[model samples]
Target chain A: MYRMASIIKTESLVKDFDGLRAVDNLNLEVEERTIFGFLGPNGAGKTTTINILCTLLRPTSGRAFINGYDCVKDAHRVRSSIGIVFQDTTLDKDLTAYENLLFHAYLYGLKREESKKRIEELLQFMDLYDRKDEPVKRFSGGMKRRLEVARGLMHYPKVLFLDEPTLGLDPQSRAGLWEHIVRLPESHNVTVFMTTHYMDEAEVCNRMAIIDHGRIIAEGTPEELKRMVGGDVVYLRAKDNKMAKEILKERIIADIEERNGEIFVHGVKGDVCIPEIIRILGEQVLSVRLQRPTLNDVFLKLTGRQIREGSPEDEFKESIRSYRRRFDRT
Target chain B: MIELKVVYVIVMRELIKFFREKSKLVSTMARPLIWLFFVGMGMSRLVPQDITGTDYMRFLFPGIIGMTILFSAIFSSISIIWDKEFGFLKEILVAPVSRFSIVLGKALSGTLLSSLQAMLIMIVSPLIGIYPEMGQIAGSVLVIIVLSFCISALGIIIASFYESLESFSMIMNFIVMPMFFLSGAMYPLKKLPLVLKYAATLNPLTYGIDGLRHILIPHGMLDFPFYLDIFVLLSTSAVFLFLSTYVFERGK
Candidate 1:
């Protein structure tokens, strides 16, 4: 296999806010023409990392580069080679969809005729050409998201950065947006570096990094990351759970844990073990389930916590984190 | 050259938004006229003519032009607050264009809109029986442009510190009011208290209105030399523009 050069690289990037470290000595590399997902929970420094890469925020120490241009020193060149769809709606609500894209074209120094052609092509591609002349305020959340994605491609950038592209979108819209995003590398010949917390969304990436507390805990393809969970999970509910555990323990050498009345058997071939376990423990088996490891399970195995279950304490921490960011900026 | 184009597009977006909002256009145009007729007529009756050296309405005419530019120019930066609130500012900020271009583009648009309002007020000068000569009108245009740019830059400087429209309204009540009242737009600086006269001298609009008086009301009592007015307005606008650009770039 031919190796591809990194289009995005960061060398021990560190960003501190008033003595609180947001990103701590992070190193990341994303190859050209690949969809690289940065996966993390809220307050994981995802936005800060993307901001640094897009030249919106300067790193406190170390360096980052996009398309070979230093994010800090050669910010202008880096900006020119990249496009960004921020987590929020960055479109001018008062302007028409066409006008918004045109403004971007002019900012990027596209010629008048070329910009018009590109805007039309992008509007059509995003399925927004029919409503191109309408003000963006009239657009649905899904439509606005699509227009934003279209706007990000207006300059034919070498790399596109999406910070939570499907955040706050309905499941249908999320799927719809992903369809468009998945086709981007082939159609636009651009690398994608996106930050998403959704496990399902991260699965779509060609490669991904799972970050926590500003550090990447794991980085690999979806299959590789899942394989780290050891093996398929088998959940067995028997009439006598203690006897079942004893019997299963004698036959199979694997980690067995009980949670909420179900015996979870880990690191086993589910198909091979389920039949024997059922046959041996015949009438004692009440219910049995075989499951493959998902990205969520992998996160749970690595971090000992579910990714999506944000307790009240986590919400409080997130709010305080955001307040600190705002205070620091001011 | 690309930076210039970046500036141009930013200005264009503002102009397009300004023209689209008909109510805003009508209200901005109407505000000066209301003060010109209602407040000018009411105050003319209370003040004696010898103090102003002309009919009080004629004296208020130049002041009204100052008022128009002051309000229009400062409030134009509300577009910045609007952009911030709606997240559109991130689009411009993330672009490859220089921050100076962004500040210049905003200031130029504010200058254009405020100057347009100032000219519209000048057209209504006939209603007050004061017709500025063609030369006077031409000179006032230069003063108006300079003053508008100065005040708009001031607004952008304030805007850089804020992110919400509610904070902007607080600014309107605090900063905008004080600047307008002290600008000598409604009264002669010579007649003001000693401390206020000093405060008025520090105001760019005072120099601006004074410059307009030199051209629009040649016989009207002038506090400072016309050259000083021009000098102060030019230097202050340059300072304001630089400061605003600095504040924007420092955020990174």
Candidate 2:
């Protein structure tokens, strides 16, 4: 048993459901007292990875450690050192805020007096002390999310995991949650491992990984990943994609993708590339429009599609539907 | 020590939720009350005296108590489905408590609430001509408590495998209705088809109703063999509870 340190570390962690690999051989090292964001499109196995790290789900193979303890071999110790807030709200709808926090504290082995103090302090920190007696069923989306965070912190866990923390919140609620999440590290020095599909959330993180198809396709600071694109981006849309590509090629302009009636061109001299691209497209009987490429472009470059593809569950449901349709026809 | 505290917290959470759902309590009690008072009374006039060997209402009272335990236990099981749907169960599963404690907490809560419902139904039994000897009420409550635990364990065990609310309700309709009927809740199994009589004997609920009847009916017209019935019911509870906790551990 190593002394408690380095909040979370995983080496070649792999998770498979039936035949489909949900998390392929993945390695991650999350430092203590840092908010590390896991960014990916939907169905990129973010939730599965989070679940494994939290000890909610065991890995299919490979090793995971939390606070210097193996997730499987020392699961209880791993669980003791981490707290998780799932993508979905999980509070008992009938319990009061105070009761929820108190229950959570007790679950972590807090004494009665310690639980009372922690609940009071957390309620105050969340600005929910005034409404502590009201059941969670009455709280708004933001308050509920905040209470979830408070509940996660009730144990003073060495590491906190938030999976898609603001997927469905209004902008105001999202912003409010961001503030709370940002303040947590400064206030508690607890390591935070959060997963989000939102780019803005990723931008706020000190470091992150872009996951897709159950693999970490890229990992770095948001700045470093964006720098992978290496220049200003120009998106050229044309009526005739083949003609556009032909024209750009003829004019000696490189780094172009022609697909689905649009041309995505990336280069250092984006402004210079635009006019040349337009003039060539005009001669080739194709209408062209140009604009800058954002992170979406970086994502498109990394993966052939947009940031992520269709969710695995969606595909599973679709196959089920098709199977039902076949049976119905018979 | 902390596992017990965690279990207590979980039980309290489940009970608090139960009390808050006013409609749940009303709907749960409504069926047993209707079956016992209105349906059972009307049917009593039809259950010719020679066949049943006791007042028809009296025979139905123990069955009503069984029904109360069944529905309340199933109602508690619905929370398992609801929590899975709403993600609350996932949260609790991920908490520091052992998976064993999670199963124990839920079963105990269901047993506690269902027994309370049984007590409430007992309060009105005398007004309906199904009065038990005061001495037997305590034994009946004890039997019902164990039965409730058994039912709750079975409910949670069923919930562990199902993924959708619609499918769960479908299973409830198919399984619970037959368990209620074939176990002699509404009618005696001795008169049913031999196949059903054999099936009824397999139903844990048959043991519960027989055991309860042993204590709750007047002058012991129902020779239920009390200790044997209680032993069977307790064994059934033990089996269901073991299966439920095993499923819970694997399911998590």
Q: Among these predicted structures, which one has the highest lDDT?
A: 1
| Candidate 1 CAPRI assessment class | medium
Each candidate structure's TM-score, on Cα atoms with residue i matched to residue i, is: 0.90, 0.84
Model 2 lDDT per residue over A204-285, tens place: 8878888877888888887777767776656666666777677677775567787666677766456676676656566553
Candidate 2 CAPRI-style tier? acceptable
**Clashes per prediction?**
0, 0
Per-residue error (Å), model 2, residue A151: 1.0
Error of 1 at B228 (Å): 1.1
Span of ten consecutive residues with least summed lDDT in model 1 chain A: A321-330
Q: What pairs collide in candidate 1?
A: none
Per-model DockQ against the true two-chain complex: 0.62, 0.34
The C-alpha RMSD of each candidate to the native structure, in angstroms, is 3.9, 7.6
Over 4 Å off in model 2, which ranges?
Answer: A2-5, A231-297, A308-330, B51-53, B218-224
